[model samples]
Target chain A: MPEPLPDEGPPSDLVSDVFARDCTSRSAFEDVTAKWASLTLLALHEGGYRFNALRRRVEGVSEKMLSQTLQALERDGFLTREVVTAIPPRVEYALTPLGQRVAGRLRALADLLEEAAPEVERAREEHPGRAR
Target chain B: MPEPLPDEGPPSDLVSDVFARDCTSRSAFEDVTAKWASLTLLALHEGGYRFNALRRRVEGVSEKMLSQTLQALERDGFLTREVVTAIPPRVEYALTPLGQRVAGRLRALADLLEEAAPEVERAREEHPGRAR
Candidate 1:
């Protein structure tokens, strides 16, 4: 055979261009590190939930923003939305398997980020009059 | 004395509240992960540079956006901008020590991300026509 037909799309060069600014990893960077996305990913990974439940659990998310965020996540394939046939028509969102794995890793990073709080605080104070 | 008054301002619970979305780290999240900020930080960490030099090195950075990115980084204390009171007013920017440490860590992460590109690509291919 001719090189086994080279499976899948060409490999991503996220690493090579990751620090280069114009690299493809920028998309991943933007997605994973956005304000509420990682946290939202964590919540969805737990199980399926309705819109109201996510709003309540996410803390400080406006309905408009939550809906927008969910749409973005769903677009990225990190989440799957299902609509149940009911009187009012219920909709629920949950993590796909890939999202689950990514969320698990992100959750661990979140834990580390939590532990780094004291250091970040000190850094902040050390530079008091700084900050943008 | 009173233990030096515990140094300065209130301790930031960034790590603890990181997953909460409304936490202070949200600011950090917004700053660090923006499209060109990380790459800009990397370039700055290399050494001080005038505005145009950075634009040239970074590739695809608009002058307005570069200025904005620099201002944000300066505000975060990750960069220090010094204006030379000369004929054309030369201003050069460089990393503060703390910024160097952060850039170092982020650079490592970028490298890991680059390395993981193949896997991410594989995941994408496996999912086929997925991705948001």
Candidate 2:
């Protein structure tokens, strides 16, 4: 709640400064950058998917973890959960406009990391002593 | 270690496919997207900072966490640590070329989050039950 830059700009007061200890954006940052959150956002960015499909695409995400991740994304306005009352409750997850924008950036980062993975592997192999 | 896309293009074998359970890039993804790692990268992207200065800039990071984060980044080739054998043996952290590329993307994501933070706050307030 401490306004560091009072006269900065229009949204200065509500700005999400991760550097600020009390900034709500800190939680936002954590939520978006979390391991499952990143994968979930990337998967949703591709298209809407049912719970099981999403879980499959993400790979290795447990049922409970996926559920928690989706709920967090929904609460952040980055995802929408729709329930299609079928024989069994079929829930689908998709990204909102805001989520799309965020996911686009995340995808770019993911791509960069993917592209650089080779070099990173080399570095690890060369510096086996440093591998952790 | 499972080769999913054997017929893919060059570097496909080395690709950091996070979707792969045993991908080396999964560790890289985790390192770069980590909360302290993200902040540390952003901080170094600005300029080289001594250990104590970095701790101050990051805010709320413990001494141990900072050390561990630095080690991870360094091992991933995202950060270069130079030890200045002065009276107190000062160590400086800075971004390498790879680090710069990764940090640039992270900064963009951080900027996007900062811009969208107000809306996220509004969403949280509207759905107090969803706040977590």
Candidate 3:
């Protein structure tokens, strides 16, 4: 068998291990990777948006899901919620520097997948069990 | 307010829309971003691994979860499952080129979060409701 890659496993040098169940990073990472959460972060990457506007930008997210996602992203310091004093108080969400960085990485991943999706669709049609 | 980002909202330029609820890419992206699924892909990026060996590499995943993750990834054409006929059939899992590309993106994301975990931890400590 070929030799395993040099970075086969995470080097112990890093202080945090995301694969570890108890790592606090896992909590924040999950909140970011959660479907709605990542999409919300990406939406905010564009610019600030009021809650309903963000829902529209995200395409199909419901009010409650987007609300919870924003709260989680806010708690992780990925985004900020600012309430503008207005007729009913306009609440806008935008990415913080950390959130911007996170969104950048997510955007890259999303871009890659979106480009490869057609190939993946073809793969699905050929999937062995698809005929079963 | 600063001019909104030119790239705001998916640009309407990509061939596929990952944010759209019915998009095929959404299904594949969700599978990849799922916690255990992502960790498994990362582990295989090192090289091929048998089922139990992979379980150990991922640290905290249960066998059932790992099995399901592998199936999802395989179905999406991100990996290949091989059965080596030995005294007892040995099953090995490895990433296809597509899987490799996916893992590369995931590792970048994972590395970023790993580096940022301490900051996130500090944020968690300061989360508004932590005092409640």
Best by TM-score: 2
TM-score: the better of candidates 1 and 2: 2
Clashing pairs in 1: A15-B114, A75-B132, A76-B132, A114-B15, A131-B75, A132-B75
Q: List runs of model 2 lying over 4 Å from the truth.
A: A1-15, A128-130, B1-15, B128-130
Q: Give the CAPRI class of candidate 3.
A: medium
Clashes of each: 6, 0, 0
Error of 2 at A125 (Å): 1.9
Worst 10 residues of 2 chain B by lDDT: B6-15
**lDDT score for residue B127 of model 3:** 83
Taking the tens digit of each residue's C-alpha lDDT, what string does model 2 give over B27-72? 7888898868988888888999999999999999999999999988
Question: In DockQ, how does model 1 score against the reference complex?
Answer: 0.23
TM-score of 2: 0.87
Name every residue pair that clashes in candidate 2: none
| TM-scores (chain A) of the candidates | 0.75, 0.85, 0.84
Question: Best to worst by lDDT, what's the order?
Answer: 2, 3, 1
